[model samples]
Target chain A: MIPDKAKELQERNLKYAQIIQDAMSGKREDMEKRIKELNLASTPKEVIHSETSIKLYRFIPVKKKLHKTPLLIVPSLILRYYIMDLLKGHSLIEHLVESGIDTYLIDWGIPGDEHGHLTFDYYIDKFLKRAVRKVSRSTGVEKINILGQCLGGTIGVVYTSLYQEEINKLVCLTTPVEFEDAGLLSVWTDRKTFNIDKVVETFGNTIPADFIHACFQFLDVKATVERYKKLYNNVLDENFLYYYKALDQWINDKIPFPGEVFRKFIRDLYQENLLVKGKFTINEKVADLKNITCPLLNIVAKFDHVFPEKSAKALNSFVSGPVDYHIISAGHVTLVVLFPQREETFKLISDFLKK
Target chain B: MFMDPAQFGKNFMDPTEFNKQFYGQMEQVFIEKMNEMIKNPAFLSSISKGVETGLDGKKKSDDLIKKYLEKMNMPTREDTSKILQYLQKIETKILDLEDKIEDLSDDLKNLKKEYGKSRKTEKKK
Candidate 1:
């Protein structure tokens, strides 16, 4: 017990000494600078196509021999697209590129006030369709694979349901299909509790980023504070500090959901639970999940607080095609961003795509 | 560092690790409580009303500002968005025209080739 106590005291003393040494040697400032200057999403990519609020990117191929069917990554519009290509060693895009899958991504750029009127139909019919066509033309493939994360997965599922001929395979990571079971978000956006029309009328074009950020904060204030506390505890550890700052940067980077699209998403999907019911429409045509005849890989995070696993897994029952459903033991963000889990997630995606 | 025997025995576990565990448990419990509160109909009603009131206030202020700005003959966000929408329409038309032009060009090339082949056939005859 004495030895243990001495060891603990020694460790604490050493940490203090290290901090003092770092400060005296001006190392802390350098470390802070390095953290601030860390090159996130460093994987090199070229923009293949660009329109109003969307830029489709094709990552520069790392391998000589590439897969026949190109994989298009569609990330949620809530945050930046770089979550797939977060850091040098931690990037899903890097892992896929290294594994010889031809990778492309849609960067839903920051929406301007004019883009407020852009509806779910406009995105699916105009932007996403154009992106798919561009990918097909560029890669010279009749059909391509799609990997959509979160809300992007919903878009992919809807798109595939509408135009099944264009997709070879569909991948959904932590994607919500049955919004009725979408936990707190569903509860918050319930027609009885929330005034969607009033909010839309007040905030003309799009919900402000700050409003979205506040919603996230309200979801779990303790967890949000815990993140900062963890950072403070590990401030002396350079490796931890680097990743912490990198992720924190992304956490704070919120984007406004386009107004009309937000309205449809909440009303049609969350309130009415129309997606799984086969009533969700795009461009005057109903999007029936049964129309998705292509192979699908639905990845669900077991502890996803944002969208529950069962909510994500609902896609499996609706589709007529073969489904490869995987429930990884990770939270929503950790499923793609954090270590071990991300590596496993990447392997699953790459292996599935190769097949 | 010198440590008393009794105090030393009690300090076997690191304080930081202990704090982390305590914090984790506290956070989890707090989050659970928050989630419960979020689901409460009364809580939801209050939050909904509060947000709507705030939004109404914002809208009224924005309208007042817009009116003042219009009186000054200055372009507002609405004006800019209108212009942008017009430009977007024009751009879409241009793109459609470009696609048509490319198709027409391809068709013209095919027609020219067909005409040349006919002339050659006539020469042979």
Candidate 2:
């Protein structure tokens, strides 16, 4: 024997619940439709430029240019080089090419068991040296302007210091020469909890993925998660989705760092801090940054988490070359691809190359 | 009320058979709608387009992630601990080596100076 008023209230409540449920179902359907629609509309291309064991990529430019000094980009072997030339509108390679700069990138290909015997000395003496010579000869220039990013930059610095006569203008982006200033990487190498020799010997050319992943996880874990979430939310348009997929593919593509090279990097650069201290020796020749005489353009990201400002900035003091250092406003990846940064960094690089 | 057997047969049905018939109709309706979507050129094109776009976004994201990881300088826990162990051992060895090298250098310098002084005395005599 419920009251008449209570019965009326219950009926109304049930009706309201039904309406709300129906609306929610409609929204769910809409979201599913959107997801399917997006999945169907995507057009992504794999742009890998590989030569021998080395692989890299170039961004296609909207506009073509006339004659320009071929710019050879060297990215760290640990990661793919596509970050520099990210997408159509916000690509360093596209921007440079449109601005009349001929660009070529060296991709350090995925290291396999065969590359286990390769060392930093091997990279410097064999691959980088041969690549530079080949590019120079192909371009009909005695010396080609070289730009190296991160570890690649360190290699470039060493190469330029040792063989300045072969290289014209050298550009180093986030390259760490002084290991003491390298922060966590330096500390870890100095401690030696991970036996580089044992790992290298076991895997040959391949360093473990778990080991590399752990290094990055230590730095701002939350920020990394938030970035992807924001990326998914912000990219509502078709073109942005294409760009996103392209970036995603390159991000997950991990390659093993060669064992001998890993050992040398940890022992020589990180532990001894030899390159900047003028105590580094490669191929029986004392490698000194003071020997670099070419025009140098050192680009350092102000908020770089990995290489840090101190490590990159230390290059100015070490190199004897006419150096122009630009402290750009961005992180490491953003230096190459982000809109405002692309304009700023490219403008500076172009201006220096012209000079 | 007087009911005809034919009328009752038309109005009422067996529960199991009725359920089966109802479910069969619903399944047919769903299949028809799905086939319509599959056959629609515009819908298929849209799906293909979306897939292509997603793949592109994935590739770019991968590149950025790889680059970021490559540039990051943070040390792993294992690396940090190992470095600490190595530092302790190296420090001891370096200190011992430094002392030995310093002593040897001082002895050589003193010997050179004394030999110079003796040669001068001999000349004077």
Candidate 3:
């Protein structure tokens, strides 16, 4: 090796040795304490409606000139609602509220034993519908806008299809519509390979959060390993450390997907691909995507492993309204977590809602 | 600009760089192989079978416990779950009542506004 290269290597080695020495000096203990005290989901909000395990929150607006039509954000049932309002400054909810969009969120709280019997129909009809009605009634507007992410987006699409007249605009963030080519999840939930009924029967009420976490972790073990590597490399970066710890906490904070809802979601959407086929039903009402005539904004992640871009973009072909389709260069989680992509996505959503 | 193969190899022979490249390739290969294995039909079937067998054993043991608890006149998970379900049903009924009452109240307010508007219109005439 060249002399300069050798010297650079020597310095890097010394740096590593110092980092190890710091680790031995209980800097890690301080990090652990700081992580424990890390405040997340810090945006101020009030519970506007509560039923069973679900709570609908209306964020206290920071701006005076609010939009006429209120915006309701629906997150995946399996994940916490805080992913949207993750940090005070770096939050989608905060951005929307600051932009003067009256915002509401459906927090699908940790399900209990009794919540296992809760079906998809109940979630769509009762939980989502009630949340929408509350937002609409409270805002005194007949029409409202909805922004849903992942599985929540699927629920929003169905809800908008059933109640298109009451929806002014619909935004879907990386929502899988054509599950036939959705990705590994579709393959894993195949009827021939997997026994959904038996699994539901065994678990009884709600699928444990750990089981879901394990499955997701199993999806990309290399990615999980690389995440730790990144965290290690950025140990000295306070900003990076804060964001990483916050995201790490959110990812680990898992919640059970109610049993019957899981069964139906896998069977109908993942296995059968019913929603795009216009055969999926909620409470005896067919949720045909063509019924969604409101202006639709579908944002899909180009590099999403969970829901492939093609699968998410399939919403555009079905919706009757004019579609504003965008495929951003980001992964499923990174679209919301990362800076540049997150900012772009927020701008797209806020601009769409402003229209 | 000419260089011998041995000298070129030596030039690139840093242990740190070698380790990074080797591990990067290994990670790629591992991920590719694992994804392929996971997508295999036989692999999926095997996993399903393992899960089903494990769950079956658990179910059998849980049944045994339930029987013993019943003999001791103690409530099992089923008993508690049934009661919870009943309470959820009652809660649903109450919510339904609340919804109906809200709708009626809105209608009453609308009727009162219409009546007040008609009386004012008659006075204007």
- Provide the clash count, candidate 1: 0
Worst ten-residue run, lDDT, model 1 chain A?
A19-28
Q: Against the true chain A, what TM-score does chain A of candidate 1 give?
A: 0.89
Q: Lowest-lDDT window of 10 residues in candidate 3 chain A?
A: A22-31
Supply the global lDDT for candidate 1.
0.84
| Candidate 1 structure quality by residue, lDDT tens digits, A1-355 | 5578568667755765564354334233453453347788788899887777678999999999999999999999888777787789899999999999999999998787868767899889988887888899788799999999999999999999999999999999999989985888888898887888888888988888778767776666667767756655676678786787677666655668888988888899999999899999998899999999998999999988889998999999999999998989998889998778888899989999998
For residues B1-125, write the lDDT of model 1, one tens digit per residue: 54344543554366655555666767788888887887789999899889988998999999998999999999987898888777766766786676578669969999999999999999999
Q: Report DockQ per prediction, comma-separated.
A: 0.41, 0.01, 0.44
Highest TM-score among the candidates is held by which one? 3
**Model 3 lDDT per residue over A112-199, tens place:** 8878788999988888888888899899999999999999999999999999988999999999889996778878888987788887
Pairing residues by index, what is the TM-score of model 2?
Answer: 0.61
The C-alpha local distance difference test score for the whole of candidate 3 amounts to: 0.84
Q: In candidate 1, which residue pairs clash? A: none
Task: Say which docking band candidate 3 falls in.
Answer: acceptable
Instruction: Tell me how far the alpha carbon of residue A317 in candidate 3 is from the true structure, in angstroms, after superposition.
Output: 0.6
Error of 3 at B110 (Å): 1.3
lDDT of 2 at B31: 57
Pairwise lDDT winner, candidates 2 and 3: 3
Q: Write the per-residue lDDT of candidate 2 for residues B58-119, one digit (tens) a residue.
A: 55674676566557965543344456546544654674465578669869999999999999
